[model samples]
Target chain A: MSLQRLAIAACLLPGLVACVNSTVDQMVFNTPGAGIGDASVVILGRRHASDYETEPEFIRCVGNHISSRDKSIGVVGEQEFLDALYPWFEPRTAPLRPADLERLLEHRDVARAFTTMQTRYMIWIDGSTVRNDSAGSMTCGIGPGGAGCFGFGTWSNDANYEATIWDFSKRAEVGRISTTASGQSYMPAVVVPIPIIAPVQGTACDSIGDQLLEFLSAEY
Target chain B: MSGSMTIGPDRWLAATLLVFLLAGCGTKQVLVQSEFPPPVMNKLPLTIGVWYDEEFANHEFFDEAAGRAETSWLVNTGQAQVQLWDTLLKGMFRDVVYMNGKPGPGQMNPVVDAVLLPAVDELQYAIPAHTNVKVYEIWMRYRLQLVTTGGAPIADWTMPAYGKTPTAFMQSDEGAVRLAAIVALRDAGAHFASTFTSIPDVAQWLASLPRAGDAARRRVQP
Candidate 1:
């Protein structure tokens, strides 16, 4: 091959490789006339049987993103939401049906607490990100002065998440956003291996948060 | 010779027919209707309020492959049960109030003496694959609770009902399932109504209510 052709190939290869390494798939259900207005929105990670609290990092990231993007609405902090909703924790679970909310709101105390918090909308985030399809291996040796690893390793990560928005005033689900992110990470070393981390959770949070803002802000 | 490399009209026709057949196999919604028995008068004249669990009241089974709701058990199990209860207890009770959704404090009718809450516990239908006979079976379980207006539970019971039917020639699987579900719901309603007033605790509670003579006296005095 000519030097020019090889140079062009070298330039294009990284772009192609990068594209193959990362993927983001998103679906948004926007309510045409729904607006967030001045109501407060709370983002919660639906509790599962294994975990009592949602990932702190994910909650904080989403809260920060939403608060930063939309200045008109107030974002309820994780601690405040948890503290207010602690009394009704037993019935809060994944795949919450519409009836569950109705039942919960039937309690005067619950309604009063939520009203006091000025929370009119709830965003329920569920699902997780995990490492998968790991290949290759690495080993490290420690010397008196320091420690160093000399090996190559590669792994893929997948993030699957869904966010459901519920309007308390309407007593119905207004919209939903589902996102999937997958990427590969690599570590190569001649003497010391530098690891590349796949920001799967961060990507998922960003995608979901941005779409949520769009759905909430749409003039439907 | 490349063994008839040119496509023929017959091959294209065969492919189109296969596609149509596959598409026709998608799930279909089935509506089930039943003829309920006429209303009967209750022995007791106390008014009752009926409340249904939201999930159970609007429950539907989805066929993911077809991307549609295939069956609505709520039709037969939730609405039907409420209707039957109203009918069977009509004469014996003063009035029956149907609370469609959760009621807040002071939202309930003050005239009603007690409330009846029904929740669907389990609902399922099964049909074995690769079966020539084409038999469908349906099962339903309901939990019934009777409570006072003050939220004091009076009585509760769980009832299970089942029905099975064979698919007729040229009949759809969805139709067979619907028929089976109807049969199960009918049997469940009948059994519940028949034995409701006979239960020792329930009968005792009914007997404790104000008698017609006493009620008339109180009204007259007031």
Candidate 2:
């Protein structure tokens, strides 16, 4: 019986590894100066293309995490940022280039609008985390009175994100934080299936948010 | 024999269940931060007024079928082109003074030596469906005109830029298009800058401008 248990444990080792294994890779660019005292920054998710449709959770998660972690720098909510940039959200227009930014700042109304927001910096988060390389499957069936799912399946997720920090005062990109996380997930079943889900998006948010705080804070 | 068979099925079911319980793991978002490169500066001390058509500047590309202006890649591309022109020109020129309107008579600023007007003639892309080895091609065309503040035409040229990128199984079509547009615009901008200085009309106009020292001396002595 002990030998049999050992064999079963060997069979399940890979799945166990899949459930617990996760890796985070990050790179930091220039850090914001410490002297900018009490100036607020807004975190925005780029809405171009299908980004708005796919990456809201990750965006919101990062924003929430950053706000919760750092007490010194104020965080602007996503809706407030959008409200300040109203009418500029038209999907047909191109992403603002550096020159367009200068032009925008020069415009009386637009300048006044941004000035009213009192945001010194803008952090644009772009990219997505998605499920990839899914293999194996489980089957579900319904009986006369009840239904249950039984089967085995496994999948992996890939998370890629880049946070670009734009200094509104300087009208330039001051820093960038980019990260990629990839890990495996599995679902196993006997009579009742047990799903071992990977918190890929959540992990990304935490990692990014922590690093962002480190990058923005004077201590780090 | 029946007991042995029942044991075999039971073991298999348990193994399957173990596997299911152990699976379903994924990576979360990780962030890596690094120092960004410093901004590049231009050597030439030239200040030009930049302007774009108001209608074109605010125009959004609308998708009639989707009934949404937001999904159109062309819109972003168009907007990106305007920004690209501004960025590239700023890097090439010492000062870029943005003007609200075309530099017509009395519309030009007295401080600027010349004015540059960039108008979008066409912005488009092609990505056909149901094809292997997906190819996205973005075409951008611009009408660039340079005129002196006094309304004398210096040079006028029509520039076209093209960007092409491939898509595989996992790549996003939107990302491919955006990248292609960026590539096309960068190419077009580089071509324009490299060729603009060589144009006879532009060369003559630039050559005619007084030297900085001469102007400074006059200012100081006067």
Go through the candidates in order and give each one's C-alpha lDDT.
0.62, 0.61
lDDT of 2 by residue, A22-107 (tens): 34454544566683467778787764542122254566787778667666767778755654543232223223553456744533
Q: What is the lDDT of residue A200 in candidate 2?
A: 72
TM-scores, one per candidate: 0.44, 0.46
- Give per-residue CA lDDT, model 1, range A127-195, as digits (tens): 666668888877887554777777888888777777878777776787777888888878776455656
Residue ranges of candidate 2 with Cα displaced over 4 Å: A1-29, A33-36, A47-54, A89-99, B1-222
lDDT of candidate 1? 0.62
Residue B56, candidate 1: alpha-carbon lDDT = 60
Deviation from native of the Cα of residue A77 in model 2, angstroms: 2.3
What's the DockQ of model 1?
0.01
Worst 10 residues of 1 chain B by lDDT: B213-222
Residue A83 in candidate 2, Cα distance off native in Å = 3.1
- The count of backbone overlaps in candidate 2 is 34
Predicted candidate 2 versus true structure: per-residue lDDT over B1-222, tens digit per residue: 355434675587688878865442221111111111111222246787877777556544433324322233333444655666676677566688887567677763656878888776877666534233245666767787898776678888787776565453466665666655654555566556545666667666666777642332222100
